[model samples]
Target: MRGYQEDTPPSSISGDEIAGMDDEEAVFLGYLDEMDELVDDNMEEVTDQEEEDTDMEPPEDLSILVFNKHVGSVFCCDLHPSGKLAVTGGEDDKAFVWSVQTGQIVFECTGHKDSVIFVGFSFDGAYLATADMSGLIKVWKCNLDENQQEPWPIAFEYEAEDLTFGLWHFGARVLICGAVSGDIYVFKIPSGDIKVLQGHNTRVECAKMFKDGVRLVAGYDDGAVKVWDLKTNAVLQQIQANVHDMRVTAIDTHPENNIMASISSDGKVILATSSNGKVVGQLQAENDLETVAFAQDPQLGFFALGTLNGDVGIWDTARQMVRHQCTKSDDESVVGVTKMIWEKDHLITGCLDGAIRVYQGRSGEKVLQLTGHRSEVLDLCFNENENVILTTSDDGTARIYKYEINKDKD
Candidate 1:
């Protein structure tokens, strides 16, 4: 070791003691210290992957919530941002609410004249919105507090037809919605005001604000991926030319929004950005895709891709490759994937076959299969209460599933 001076012996390396005994040893030791720091920062990650390696099994203890039926197929669902309740939309042309904890039906919202395609919560869990094929979006004032018996009345509404999808900006009170007419509308929550954004040459399949509200991304049937500035509401970039060989079904941003990915009906998954507006990498699952989710933890940078053909591919986004994939039995093609949510080591899956399965994110395996819905389970949400899961299905119902996490699983 090189000696440091207590007072005045601090001359820089010059003579034999400074240079003599161990030049190579000093350089090697410095390199070792640098490596040690890197290891310390990354040790938890290495441990997580190792845990994935040993146990890919879903947890065993899964129980059903309440199941209240709708008249027709339930098309979509959104959990109250509080996770204490759920709102579901369906072919029945109605919306219903359920208690997440007790598995009980609470309210059935009636207003939309046609089938409801999508529903979502405001950032604070105070408001909710649902969209239908008629191009109308209804905003409702909701109270998730279990103390209330009757549901709250409709607070406000926005009208749109040929509607595709709508999502609130990350944790903001504003919403960005898109329609088949190639118009993207941004709605100010609870106020019922709207802005129509125009650019795409065809129907917009999905619209969501990314990078907090700094940027907005929309995918259209023309295979075009467009980015917009949230403030000026201007098009920032556009990348087109057949993203999949078919329709672009869904798109979502990485947690940071610096990168985003889109899925095409022809089985294409693209990783791209707004700056250069090019796909960094791409993957084709077995069949057309439904939804894609990025992991919450940044360093893990994992993603789960759900396909219409019953195939789910888990990706290490940093490595840009499928780390593991699983197909349910041999007969089930993944018709849908709700979202990839992490609970400790598990990534819970909600499938179109009305089955909710959990898998170890590190290795793709069926950990638990929650069977209850008589039809396709279209939407699911996790978090809030970490041990519980919420799902809505085509059987015109919403159900919650609960479980206990054991130390062995962790």
Candidate 2:
């Protein structure tokens, strides 16, 4: 019988030296050698993977034009009806009308006592309105002549009580504004005439003009929704406060029908008729709701909703159910959605993570992500032709991205 070495360890004995040991000891030493080789191979692979990951770069900035003049957070932005210019208001208490083609400042709207909360162009692109949080509203007549170098004249001005939001009529020279005091003011631009619609002592959170251009829908902080007659200054219909149970965040009217959709901060979505204010449908989400938008085409019979939890749900109006849910990647943190709009078959969303995501409206899959802003997106609007998007952010900047249809998705 062969004697075995008692003091030496298997790892210290090499395969060449194992021949002098007992058969059992030699086999154990051989196994140890093989295990050492396997560990070395794994370490090499891991080191190479780490190096590759370290070399990866962040996504490129996709904005075609960046507006960096605002000294503070940009609160609102709009594209001109002719798609030749853009207007943005910010916490800097200033508003700028800049050319889209050259990004040159066409006019600087100043003299606001507080932050400019809203800015937009009129339906015909002849008037531009800028409003501040302290209720200072100024309307400017846009001079489109390329040879004209003078500043646009102030056509109208008014001071209300703590204004919250403003809207422009789609077909007329009417500018509607909502106030914290629950009063909705309608102003006929250039004339400075005003009509006041009283609310039930709750702040008017959001409002929209109907396609007919005669009626308006306003949502309140107490969860009440009212359809008001612009001509009569009377409530045409009302949805009582018990339905939403929270502050209304947004409201949108259908393009070709009497249906209106309103979302509340408590995650309740109410679909009602703009004519009678009758509750036609309702959807409840598990997270707080932030924004909602109806498809541009009425034939699609669906609308998209955004949540504070980074969820996008495309709901079928006829079925009263979610057709598809768009979610973020697993590696991504929760990114709240602040605003959204539908253009043709696409859903464009502005997120708190500072990304503008474009989703395929038919499949609910994200097709493109545009990045540039360093803070939350406050608002967004697209050109009349839907080939460009203008977005404002809390980062004190606004950016424009060219919208190209991804034909591969079709």
Score every model by TM-score.
0.76, 0.83
lDDT, candidate 2, equals 0.87
**How far off is residue 302 in model 1, in Å?**
1.7
User: What is candidate 1's lDDT per residue for 1-410, written digit by digit as tens?
Assistant: 22335687543644565456577867875696798787776786777888986676533424566556677677777776666777778888887777766656777777788898888888788788878888878877886666788667787776766777777776678877777788888888777677778855689888656756678888888788888887787888776566556777888777777788888877788888757688788887756578887776666678888866667777889789878875543344445665455665567777766778777676676666777776677777764555567777667667777654332232
Rate residue 240 of model 2 by lDDT: 56
Candidate 1 local Cα displacement, residue 389, angstroms? 1.3
lDDT of each: 0.73, 0.87
Report the C-alpha lDDT of model 2 over 1-410, residue by residue, as the tens digit: 22346975655655587568988987776797798798788878888899987785634778888898999899999999888899999999999999787788888998898999999999999999999999999999999887898888989999899999998998999999999999999999889999999888989999988888898989999989999989999899997559888898899989875799998888888999877778988888855788889997888888988987888889998788888888743245667799999888889899997898888888877788888887789999987464788999998989988886544232
Candidate 1 weakest ten by summed lDDT: 401-410
